[model samples]
Target chain A: MNERQRARRPGGRSARVAAEVHQAVTDLISERGYGNFTVGDVAARAGVADSSIYRRWGNLETLLSDVALTRLNAQSPMPDTGTLAGDLRTYAAQVACEITGPDGLLLVRLAVALSTNGQQGLQARDELRDERTRQLQSMLDRARERGEQAPDALGVLDHILAPMYIRVLFGIGPLTPDYVDGLVDRLL
Target chain B: MNERQRARRPGGRSARVAAEVHQAVTDLISERGYGNFTVGDVAARAGVADSSIYRRWGNLETLLSDVALTRLNAQSPMPDTGTLAGDLRTYAAQVACEITGPDGLLLVRLAVALSTNGQQGLQARDELRDERTRQLQSMLDRARERGEQAPDALGVLDHILAPMYIRVLFGIGPLTPDYVDGLVDRLL
Candidate 1:
C-alpha cells in the first residue's frame, strides 16, 4: 500500500472495531433490554477485549451514550424539499424509519433509560437533544430564508418528533406514512 | 368496636399493605431505576413479607403494572368545563402535574421499562396505554355529545399527552401553564 493508505490503516481499523462494538451493543439491547448487559458482555459479543471497551468508553453508560449519539449523528441528512411541508414530511418519514427499524426502539429505550441514571447520563441525554434541535433548526432556518412560514424548532419537536417517539416508547402503533404526514400537516 | 368496624379492619389492612408495597416499588424505581432491584428489595423497603407480595401481585412486572394502573385510575376525574377547550386544558394540566410530580416520571419509566421484558411486560404496557386511551375517549365523547367540536382520541393522544410524556421521558422542559394550554389550544 502507498504512504496515504498506510496512514489511513489505523483509523480504518479503529472504525471497524467501533462498528463491531456498536453492533454488539445493539444486539444485546434487542435481546436483553437496557441495563441487563455489561461492558464485558459487549466485549465478548463483539470479539474485543474488556479493556478495549473500558479504555475507549470509560464505562457502560459512556459506551451506550457513544452508540446512541453516533447513531443520531449518522441518521439521514436534513431534507430540503422546496416547501416547508415537503421538508417536514420527508424529515418525519426519515425519523419514522429510524425509530421503527430493527434496532430503532432499542436505541430510543437506551436514551430514555440513560437519562435517569445520573449526571453523566443526563448530560448524554442533553447532548442528544441538542444535536437534534440543532439539525431541526437548520432546516427551519432554510425555510424561513425561502420566505415560507416555518414552525419553531420546539414546535416541530413537540408536534412531529414527540408523537413518533412516544408511540415507539409505548409500542402504541405503527408510524404509518399518513400518520407521519398528518403530524406535519397539522403543524403547518 | 361495632361489627361494621371489625369487618372493615381486614380490608383496611389489606389496602394499607398494598399502598406500602406500591410506594416501595416507586421509591426503588426512583432510586435505582427499573431492573436494578427485585421483589425482595421492595418487600424490605415496604416492611412486608416477600410471600405476601408474591401472593398478591404474582411478580415484579405485575406489581409495577398495578402501581402504574392504580395511579392512573386515581388521577382526577374528567373535566367538564362547558367547552371542549376548557376540558382539554384542565385535562392536560392534570396530566402535566401527574407526570412531573415526585413519583410521576418513575412510574412512567417503570411502565416503559416493563414494556420490553416479555409477553407479560408487553401486556402491562398495553393495559397502561389502554387505560389512558379510554380516559381520553371519555372526555372526547362528552365534548361530542355537547355539540362542541372535539379532536379525536388519537389526535389528543398524539398532540397533547404524547408531547407531555415525551418531555418528561427526556427531562426536556417543564410543562408550564402556557405550554399546557397551548397544547390544548393547538388541538382545538
Candidate 2:
C-alpha cells in the first residue's frame, strides 16, 4: 500500500468496529436496559471479540462513556427554511422526532441519568450541550440577520425547548405539530 | 368503635405500608436498577410483609406506577417570598435539590421509563403534571394580583421551568444559583 493508504487502513477498520460496538451498547441499553449485561454480552452482541474490547477499552466505565458520548455527539444537520417561523418549526419538529419513539426516549433519559453521575461524567456531556447551544445561537443570529426579532437562546429553550422535552420524558402531555408552530409564532 | 375512628384505622396502617413499599421501590431501583427483582425483593428491602404489597398493588407494574405517580405528586409548597425573584429563587433551589441527588435523579428517569410503557401508566402521571401546572399558574396569578408582570402558566413552564429540568436531566451544563436567577430575571 502507498504510505497514505497504509496510514489510513488501521483507523478505517477500527472505526467500523467502534461504531458497531457503540451502536450495540445503546441498542442493548434501550432494548434491554443496562443492568443485566456483561462485556462478553456486549462483545457477542456487537460481533467484536471480547479480547478486542479489552485491548481497546480495558475498562467498563470508559467503554460505556464512549458509547454515551458518541450518541450525544451525533447532531443532525439543521434544515434551513429561510423564514423565521419555518426555520423554528423545522427545528422543533426535528427535536420532537429525536426525543420520542421507544428507543429514542429511553436513550435521552439514559443520557441524562448517566451524565449526572458525577462531575467527570458531566464534562463531555457539557461540551456536547454547549455545542447544541451554539447551534441554537447560530440559528437565532441568522433570524436576527434576516430582521426577525428572535428571542434569546435561553428564553427560547426555556419556553419552547424544555416543555417539549418534559412532555416526552414524563409522558406528561402531548407535543403535537400545532403546538410546535404556536411556540415558534410566539417566540418570533 | 366510633365511625370516624373505625374509618381511619385500616387506612392508617395500609397507608404506612404503601409508603414503605413505594420508598422501597425507588431505593431498590436507585441501588440495583429496575431489572432483576421481584415483589419479594422490594418487600425484603422494605421490611414489610410481601402479602401486603401484593394485596395493595396487585401487580409489579401497578406498584411501579404508584411509586412514579407518588413522587410526581409530592410537590413541596412553593414559598411566596413577596417578589417574583425571591419566589423563583426558592423554587429553583428546591428543584435543583430535588432532581440532583442519586435517588432523586434516578426517580426522574424511572418516572419517564415507567410512564411511557402504556396508556394506563401515563394517566396518573398526566394528572400529577396538571396539578403542577395549576400550582405554577396559581403562583403566576398571585404575582399578577400583586401587580408583578409575571408570565402565564404556559409561558412560565415552557420557558422558565423546562430549562431547569433540562439541565438536571442531561448534565447539559451547570444549574447554579446565578443561572437560576438569570432565568427568573429573563422570564420576569
Candidate 3:
C-alpha cells in the first residue's frame, strides 16, 4: 500500500473502536443507568481494556456525554419549502422521528440525571442545551431569509418545538407525522 | 365546639399529613434520586409513622408514583382573552414559569426516572401527558367555536406547546413570553 493509505488505516481502526465503545456504553447506561454503570463494566462490555477506555474518554461522565449527548446532529438543513408551514411540517416530522428514537430517549435520560446532580451536572446539561438552541436558531434564520416567515420567527419555532420534546421525554403521546403536520399547519 | 366538628377533625389532619408526606417524598427524590431513597427514608423525612405512609401510598413505588405523577392543578380557570394569541401566550407563559421553577425540576427528574424504567413506568407517563393534552385541546376547541381559529387551529397549539416542555426538561433554553407570542402568531 502507498504511504498515505498505510497512514489512513490506523485512523479507520480507531474510528471503529470508538463506535464500538460508544455503542457498548449506551447499552450499559440503558440497562443499568448512569449511576450504576462503572468504567470496568463499559470496558468489559466494549471488549476493551480499562486503560483503553479511560485513555479514550478521560472519565465516566465524559464517556457517557460522548456516547449519549455529544453525538447528535444538532444541525439539520433547513428545507426551502417556500412557505413557513411547509418548512415547519418537514422540520417537525423529522424532529419527532428523531426524538422518539432510542438516541432521543438516552439523551433525555442523561439530561434528567445531569440536571438534578448539582453544579457539575447542570453545566454539562447547559452545554448540551446551548448546542440545540444554536441549531434551532440556524433553522429560524434560514426561514426568515426565505420570506416564508415573519420578522421574528424564532418565537414561533420555540413554542412549536418545545412541547414535542416535553411530550417525548415525558412519554406524553406518539410523535406521529399527523401530529407534526397538524402542528405545522396551525403554528406556521 | 360541637362533638361532630371535633370528631371530623381527624379527616382534616389526615389531609394535611398527606400533603406534607407528598412534599417530603418529592424533595427526597430530587435530592437523592429514586433508586437510593427507601420507604423508611421517606417516612423519616416526612415525619410520619411508617404505617401511615404505607397505609396512604401502599408501597415505595406507589408512594413515589403518587407524589411524583399526580397532576398539581386543582381546578384552575381557563384563559379567556377573546383572542387566540392572547389566550395562548398567557397559558404558555404560565406553564413555562412553572416548568422552570423548583417544583417543575422535581417533576422533571421523576419523569426521567419513570420513563427509563420500561413498560410499567410508561403507563404512568402517558397519563401525565394526557392531562396536558386535554387542557391544550380544550383551549383549541374554545377558539374554534369562537371562529378565532381555523378548522385545524389545534395544530398550532401542538407545535407551539411541545417545544417549551422539551426545552425546559432538557435544559434547552428559557421559555420566555416573547417566544410564546411568536409561536402563537405563527400558529394562529
Best candidate (score: TM-score) = 1
lDDT tens per residue, model 1, A62-114: 88877877777678568888888988998899889998876666555766677
Model 1 backbone overlap count = 0
Give a tens-digit lDDT track for model 2, residues A1-188.
77546434766877788888887887777666644466888899999899888878774545776675555445345557897677788888877776665555644555554564466446545555666678788888898999988888776676677788776765645678888777777667
Error of 1 at B37 (Å): 3.8
1 or 3: which has the higher lDDT? 1
The alpha-carbon deviation from the true structure for residue A78 of candidate 3, after best TM-score superposition, in angstroms, is 8.4
TM-score of each: 0.83, 0.75, 0.70
| Residue A116, candidate 2: alpha-carbon lDDT | 46
What DockQ, on C-alphas, does every prediction get?
0.52, 0.53, 0.46
Clashing pairs in 1: none
Model 3 CA deviation exceeding 4 Å by range? A1-13, A47-55, A69-94, A101-104, A118-123, A126-161, A185-188, B1-11, B47-51, B58-62, B68-71, B74-90, B118-120, B130-160, B170-172, B184-188
Ranking by TM-score: 1, 2, 3
Cα lDDT tens digits, model 1, B38-141, are 99999999999999898888888888888877877678567878878888888888889988876666555765677657887877778777877788788889
Between candidates 1 and 2, the DockQ winner: 2
What stretches of model 1 exceed 4 Å from their correct place? Answer: A1-11, A36-62, A73-75, B1-11, B38-59, B75-77
